[model samples]
Target: MHYCQSCETPVAMEPRNGHAVCPECGRADDVAAPGPLFVVTGASGSGKTAVLAGLARRLQGRCVTFDADLLMDAAGALSGSRPIDWPAFRDAWLAVAHGVAQSGMPTVLLGPFIPTHLQELPARRWIGDIHFIVLDCPDELRRARINARPPWRSRDIEEQVEFGQWLRRNIADRVDTSSELQKTPRRPSPHGSTAI
Candidate 1:
């Protein structure tokens, strides 16, 4: 058994591509370093997925996009008061993000994430740079969007909306999506402006 240098967790010593790999985190000692990561965070109705889809199209061939929800196993959390298994979610997200970054492509991650979530990832040490952007939409507009997609739990929507408000007040980079709802999805500039 070997211990991962990054996570300090015991891992099976599996050799792959002439390097010892960590089974749990898929960390290889000899792999090329990863590229910078740009994380786009927003609440449920804040248009995170749409924004990321547009970004992926605009940055085609130069970047890859991943939805954090797909990396997480939230079934347990959904039935409880908490909505995520922070440790498990963090580990899974880091593994995939690190692997994608190692391929030399910038990664765009979309999810309901806060800055603190990024800090908990084990891959933080290896990542080159991280750019965080929070998508914002007005409460009324957000509620309308959520309502249109019926069958959603009221409590969940309220929680997400509250989080979105908190993000707008605290996060440095925020892009308002209220206007985007009226027009086509455009590329967002690095400085947090929606480009035409």
Candidate 2:
């Protein structure tokens, strides 16, 4: 939250054009042009986390990359005692991405986000168009990878495989991570003004 200098009102800062202005006072804060959001989505064990690690390094100063899992701990806060409100959780990540865009860096979020998880959100207005890239691998490989993980992760292989197929059918961009496992993360599919 930003404070309006003249009126001392708390401002929920969101970029307009290329700047964020205090609605109370109309005093503008210089914010960089908003950048499009890039979402690298996949089912569990589809190499999203591994890919994010590489992207954070490779994208260094060019753009910012993040794992949506970083906010998992705060899910309780967002949802209270009820089951996690997934849409609210997604909104938080979108807000973070929009804030980063104000600093002139495009953001790539790594997670299990489908288009519906983002496209209709209120926060979507603060960022540019969203582009989704699904990371994919053979079903056998995906199962083996999830099973190899520590016991805490869900090992429901069939469910994940089904989800992966849905993503492939609905999203046009896909990175066959099994083929690229030895390589660094594949570059994300391009979108409206983002350099990634």
Candidate 3:
């Protein structure tokens, strides 16, 4: 069974115009194939950046790693307030991912992304197997971590902690980094299907 690169749903073996089309999203698998795209997402101060950095160091030159915030900042898509411009952020991110994929490298994207934010990405049609991994921590620990950062905003930290709790409850693959750090990042299997 082949999975849709866009929505990660299992598509029938039947091919359309030489490509397996995702029935749910109507995205052709070939067009959406950007190798393997792993999104490591979590709330603010969730240790995602640290985890990705460790993974990159372990992988040596095998993969490409990028932070979504830096990408957004470079594109001027992020603001200092609530309600982000998702469409613009998605576009800019996809452009960078596409470039990385075109270079024949797997991508590890670290960011603060809810499930819905990923589902609504316009460039999903051109993305390959998208794996989502959410890092979680206790509220107190998260608060402490956020507070340790310079120029921290209390409101933003509170919001992030709340969202982190919600994400730990809602997301399927969650790693609790409160006590121990994950030494290695695992590559997602090509098997199984899920609705976007």
Tens digit of per-residue lDDT, candidate 1, span 21-64: 77777787765354677888888777865666567789889888
Q: Candidate 3, after superposition: displacement of residue 135 in Å?
A: 1.0
121-173: candidate 2 lDDT, tens digit per residue: 87777778899999998888888777766655556788888998898889899
Q: State the weakest 10-residue window (summed lDDT) of model 1.
A: 187-196
> Where does model 2 exceed 4 Å of error?
1-16, 20-32, 182-196
TM-score ranking, best first: 2, 1, 3
Measured on C-alpha atoms, candidate 1 has an lDDT of 0.67
lDDT at position 23, candidate 3:
77
Worst 10 residues of 2 by lDDT: 187-196
TM-score of model 1 vs. true structure:
0.70
Q: Tell me model 3's lDDT, rounded to 2 decimals.
A: 0.65
Give a tens-digit lDDT track for model 3, residues 16-120: 543657677877655323566778888876777557657778766887887675654444434565555667676667656755776677788877776577666
Against the true structure, whose TM-score is highest?
2
